[model samples]
Target: MKRRSLLKLGLGGAVLLGLVGGGMALLKPGLVDKHMSPSARELMRAVALSVMDGLWPAPGAARDAALQAHLDRVDANIGGYPAAVRAELSQLFALLSSSGGRLALIGMSQDWPKASVAEIQELLNELRLSSLDLRQQIYHALRDLNTIAFFTAPEHWASTGYPGPREIP
Candidate 1:
């Protein structure tokens, strides 16, 4: 194919993919809002485990509770974001929740719940180091969300040695 044709084809494919993803997000209105759908929650839980690693609690009730709290904080944080930012995050979450997206973006064929932390970590590392700007952006977004959620709680501040914000008179 001619260079012009090749570029056109690629651009067309990208547009189509974006439209489909946007449609999916629209179909599940809750998915695009501050409230995370079940699938988005699961995806983020896996991402939190992988990204937080040592900071995350061990595999037990404490870990489960901590993860839930982190997710709740993430939801609250997203709620405070501008509409456009929320829309973009919703699209990213929708894409990652799909099977094809899981494989293509993170190279994980299995569902998030079943994937091991090691596996998820490897995939996340790939995204972090990927030459593709989109993948790196995804990595940063996930990592930042998890990090912010985990550390914002006063309970977790001890780990980072962040003394509670100085008492303002």
Candidate 2:
């Protein structure tokens, strides 16, 4: 009787372990795990990092100009993003502008090599805050894509087949 009871207890424990392991497998990221390939995840990370790179402090005009050039290249390649994503990007862009303004203001207070230490420090602080704020905005935008159902349906408009954008005339 004692041996039978012990065997039953061991079996129950194994079953419980199996159930928990299966549950954890199911709990893991479903869509991201199955849908987003490695390349896609890397691309998303690159986009976020590009935004972060823009917010970094640039001391010299040459470095600043180079950063601007890189940004233009990325802009041309990325093209027009979706409307919802664009709105969030715009918010981050505004923060970048604010950081740039601080840099210019601090530049004004001191000479090329020797500037107001306090203003420079303040500019760095502002840039850090701006970067953090932008990170949050980007996260919110990506997280939203997981849940928001943007398109409920679809339609097609063609010439002669339906009333298209061109007009009847």
Candidate 3:
């Protein structure tokens, strides 16, 4: 096939995939206007485990509670965003929730819950350094959200060596 034909084929395939992904998101409006859905929570948990690796306590009840708390904070933070931003996030969550989106976008063939922290970290690094603007943007959004949620809690400040804000004179 001619180079031009191949380019067109690739572009057409991307568009088709985008359309299918959008349709799937619309079909499942979990994260659209509401609080974090189960899938979204799971996605964020996986991301948090990867991004906040050493920050988390050892694998036990405390770690589990901390993870849950982080998710709650993330949900709260997302809730405060404007509707348009929330809608965009909803679409992003929906896309990642789908297997095709996970593979095509993040190169992760497994479901979020099943994916290991190392796998997630590798995908996140790839996203961070990817040539594609969309992938990089996704990485930033996920990283920013997780970091913001984890850091904003006063209880976590000690871990970061950020003594609570100095008292007013």
How many steric overlaps are in each model, in order?
A: 0, 0, 0
Model 3 lDDT tens row, 1-169: 9999999999999999889888978986448456877888899999999999999999999999999989989999999999988988888888888888777777778899998999899989999999999999999999999999999999989998999989899
> Any runs in candidate 3 off by more than 4 Å, and if so which?
30-32
Candidate number with greatest lDDT: 3
The sequence of per-residue lDDT tens digits that candidate 2 reaches over residues 55-103 is: 3346587655544444343343334456554443433333222323213
The candidate that wins on TM-score is 3
Pairwise lDDT winner, candidates 2 and 3: 3
lDDT of 1: 0.84
lDDT order, best first, reads: 3, 1, 2
**What C-alpha lDDT values do all the predictions have?**
0.84, 0.38, 0.89
| TM-score winner, 1 or 2 | 1
Residue 149 shift from truth in candidate 1, angstroms: 0.8
How does residue 105 of candidate 1 score in lDDT?
64
